[model samples]
Target: MPPARPPSRTPPDGPPSAPLRALVSWALYDWANSGFAALVQTFVFAAYFARAVAGNETLGTAWWGNMMGVAGLVIGLGGPVLGAVADHTGRRKPWLAVFTTLCIAATALLWFVRPDPAFVLPALVLAGIGTIGSEYAMIFYNSMLPDLAERTRIGRWSGWGWGLGYAGGLVLLVLALYGLVRAPGWFGIPHHDALNVRAVMPLTALWYLVFCLPLFLFTPDTPSARVPLSRAVAGAAARLRGSLRDLRNHRHIALFLLARMFYNDGLTTMFAFGGIYAAATFGMDSSEVIVFGIGLNVTAGLGAAAFAWLDDRLGSRRTILLSLMGLVVPGTAILLVKSKTLFWIFGLAIGIFVGPVQASSRSWLAHAAPAEVRTEMFGLMALSGKLTSFLGPFLVGWLTLATNSQRLGMSAVIGLLAVGLAGMLFVPEATAHGREQDRA
Candidate 1:
């Protein structure tokens, strides 16, 4: 198609299967930072921000959504450009390291965000930094899919990564529940002080640092290109424009990213607000929310492991289609159900499908991306995902504030998911077997 390009990275030369050590190391990166996802984004900090910081559940939820929307906007704008630079330089690890450090540092700084209205602006700023950093780092991590597994096996590996991430999240959630929520004063931090909750921020940062080490040490990334940063950016922009002009050959991939963008926006909005949703809607406390997070993580971990195998067998596109539909049913159900028990049930459904949807989406792109531009393509994928990313959260915020009904506000996600599902009808699966045949 395009000219033959060099490998994205100078990974070890071997058989089609990646070495066990390398694979595990790669997957552990997911494990490393999941604490941030569960603790900061989904479970603890988000709820705390809404209730404790913002001072009112409804307004707090709206503010939290607005903060995430802003971060998504910046990420959407910058992800592709940064990804192109990485591809051109042939060095993803350095950029990843920089962003990971930012994520960890910003997350740690969140420990200082207190209940005063004076702290809300600073808290939002730090949270936005962490969110954008985490998101940008993932583009490079996701690009590794092409290097880590052969086309036939990428889905399973992607699933393995996600499952382990959820497992990690579950472990951290349990620990936080034990040390902070359940016991209240187990760590010598008074319950009234709420240091128990704030302390978890630094711990999550440390956990991310420790687990991420294996990847930095063991997983070899591309060697740096000698090109200057300015030239790399210019070159990347030119290539992207050329690719856009050649959309006929890339139509299916284009559709998939477009579909992924909308669906992921809905999914992100659901996740960003889930903890706040439960707290406001059901009056669930910290302990109950932690339990919910644990259960969902457990279900998602198991589902990720199971669906990974299914992805290869069913075809990545089919697997993703099933996962998207799976999300739609429960996502809508959340709007209907009032009981905490029913919310838990539907939340588990969301968990079951979320892993597969993510894993297969990546594998689908990895299958089609030329080796030369893997990082760039994944960045574009990230871009698409972040482009309308603000829409779901923004809509949720607006409706929640206007109608003063959080549940009714969440219904907005269903519309996004349904449109994405419709878009999939045009996304023809470009089979891996055909590519293998071409290679022969």
Candidate 2:
């Protein structure tokens, strides 16, 4: 069905509207905290958590997947409801502050995770808490996009944010590799204690807290009326219900989200398991993994920057569609290679496409959602991406358990990419009449 005309709410805030300092400050959050994502979630700690904590490669991989599965369940269900609450409260900064503290504290605390079986569950739980803090915080962070820059430039801003995140991750990974390579005890800590790996947690926490101040101190926020907490909850619930009821009327938004839900599952699964899969499949130690991570981050940073203009010129839908198509081919080819050389080549392909898929998806959401409900819609956007977020992880865990082959387990992501691409074909172009006016 053709979507009914959307109601009015979005007001354009173009480049002239948002100062460059505020724009950089806004984007810097992506740059600041991505070290946690690269080090903990994607590379060093995930591998360490699985191999060192869980005690066996196969079981550790499964447990790691399951841990993230649990995090996904929490993030998927909570993001929308919380987003609705934020929309009504008109207090994005306060919530961002709370979650920022939560994430930083949680990351720094990972220094204490001992290499014992008893530590696994608690470690996973802590990681889950950090994941929630970062992911939940982004519900508010992302909602600010529509108001930060005009429609024509949203993609550029989104892409740069993503690019900066990759760059941040890359820089941290390089530092980490240098530290590890110089000596296991390079920081005056003994190698016997495994402190080298654990040391990064505290450092990332420090890095994130330091660089994130600009956005907290500088960027402006939406004005909202004060409502009692109890009343706000009731209002948010009603708004969420209204959004659900109105989905059919906003069919393209619904489909766009649905497409994202599937592709994001694949994207997230690749990230969650990429380190473990590489380590298990290729016998890559910490130093090698860090190098691999740095390579991917470099390509991803460059790719996101390159695609930002493409997203604006070609439209968000086509840009995302192209990126997803790019994913399928590389994702399959990775399965065929075992050497570091071949893996790097194919892995970089994954890197190049992944950024465009993410940046354009955000751009599309910013373009497609109704203004009044943009925050709420982005929340649902998080919900959609995360709701089935477990399916891919659980499958990777379960398949690896059953088959004892991480290669076969990794293949699960390609199907999701293909499915999402097919779904994207059904979404209407973002330039529909009412949305077009919002861009102006």
Please give the CA lDDT of all the candidate structures.
0.84, 0.84
Question: What are the per-residue Cα lDDT tens digits for candidate 1 across 109-150?
Answer: 998988777888988999999999999999999887677677
- Lowest lDDT sum, 10 consecutive residues, model 1, at 431-440
For candidate 1, give the lDDT. Answer: 0.84
How good is model 1 by TM-score? 0.94
Model 2 score (lDDT) = 0.84
